[model samples]
Target: MTETTAEIVLFDGFDELDAIGPYEVLENAAQAGADLEVDLVTLDETDLVTASHDLRVEPQGTLGQPDILLVPGGGWTSANEGVRAVVEDGVLPDKVDACYTEGSTVASVCTGAMVLAEADLLEGRPAATHQVAVEDLEAHAANVVDERVVDDGDVLTAGGVTSGLDLALWLVEREFGADVASEVSEEMAYERGEVFG
Candidate 1:
């Protein structure tokens, strides 16, 4: 089987759980023998990124068109210098749009959906995001769903912070197999959540 390469996009003021939850799931799936490659990446060349909760992380590499490109949201509601800043700066969204190809799937965690929306990726697409950003997502012309995860073919979106785990698990099941996803979830002692596509 071919390996699936997944990159969790990191940025300053990004939510800790939004990125790490999926990171842990995919990495565990890899350790469980799933053909997966997971990495933390920044949209631009950066040494370190400070998350919403003050956690510091060094990106493994710059963002590229991986099989799965996961974007994490932070400070969207409070307008802190994270997701909102990235959205306003516009560079990250542009890069995200450019990096997406027919061979890749773009995913978002929490308000990271806003970034996808900013890139015009979610327009008329079924998606999900943090409750706080539901109206904002709708404002972007996305068909917002209340489920924990919404998989719309090439674009996957997850609700609030912890739902990223569900998104990643779903990705594992979709790409690898249900058996491998179950193994990873069992290893992590996690119960899979609802998904809507």
Candidate 2:
């Protein structure tokens, strides 16, 4: 069986659910025998990062080129540290662009779409993001959509916090099989929402 590696990018002020929801779904898929390796990674040298809700997470390692790169949104609405800070710093976006160029399937959860926008990856692409950041995404020239998840070929995006689950389940189904995705959702007792491609 071919092994697929997935990295969920974690940063300071990232929403807990945005990262953890997909992490759990992928972990369950791995448990169900999907030939997948899932990891929580950071872009900086600091090891322990705090979430928006004050939840602390120790990332496995620095971001690397993975088969799937998952970006989670956090402080996009506010002028605080989170998506906005990452965008301004430009390091994360540059890394994301490099990974994408290297054939990583880029995905975003919630306002994480803003980071993709910064990388110039979502422009003219049908994507979804947190409702509050929809206009901002549009300003970046993205064709925003209303759905739990939007799949535009290699670039996938999901709306709001809970939609990360749907995005992850979709990835499991797309990469592995429907049976695996169904088994993962059933294992998590999660009912997936609609996915617009």
Candidate 3:
């Protein structure tokens, strides 16, 4: 069977749960005999990056034109910066514009949806993201909603950190079948949440 490629796209100050939860789901699926391939990647020259919480990750490699591009959201508080820094930089939005096409799927978690918005992909499309980012998404002209996961065919988006797990499992169900997704969910002990279309 041909393996489906899923990339957990990372950036500096990325939220740990938003990135890792989905990654673990995909990894567990592959281990359970799913024909899937998953990796962590970034556009940066260096493989190593420091997340918002100071968790460091040396991604598997740089990105390619992946079949599934999952952008994870980070958070921020008075204590430290997270998504605010990326939004301020405005570099990643350009990269996101170049990376996606009609043939592949593009998805986001939390404020990562803002990156897609910055890339002009969310205009007139239904999407969901972290509550903190909903207004920003609407400002980007997206048809935003409050949901655990939102599926707009090739473009999928999820809310906040833990929702990454929901989106990942949903993708497994979408790519393989309900049985495979259920098995993976059971193995991971993740209760599947509502998926909005």
Task: Tell me the TM-score of each prediction against the true structure.
Answer: 0.96, 0.98, 0.93
Top TM-score prediction, candidate number: 2
Candidate 2 lDDT over 144-176, as tens digits, reads 999889999899999999999999999999999
Poorest 10 consecutive residues by lDDT, candidate 1: 95-104
Clashes of 3: 0
- Between candidates 2 and 3, which one is better according to lDDT? 2
Q: How far is candidate 3 from the true structure (C-alpha RMSD, Å)?
A: 1.9
Identify the superior model by TM-score, candidate 1 or candidate 3: 1
TM-score of 1: 0.96
Report each candidate's C-alpha RMSD, comma-separated, in the order given: 1.2, 0.8, 1.9
| All candidates in order of TM-score, best leading | 2, 1, 3
Q: Which is the better candidate, 1 or 2, if ranked by TM-score?
A: 2
**Residue lDDT tens for model 3, 1-197:** 66799988787789999999999998988887779899999876685888878999989988787889988888633223566666667776776777675456888988889888888889998899888778878988999988999999988999888999999999988988888899999988778999999
Winner on TM-score (2 vs 3): 2
Q: Which residue pairs overlap in candidate 2's backbone?
A: none
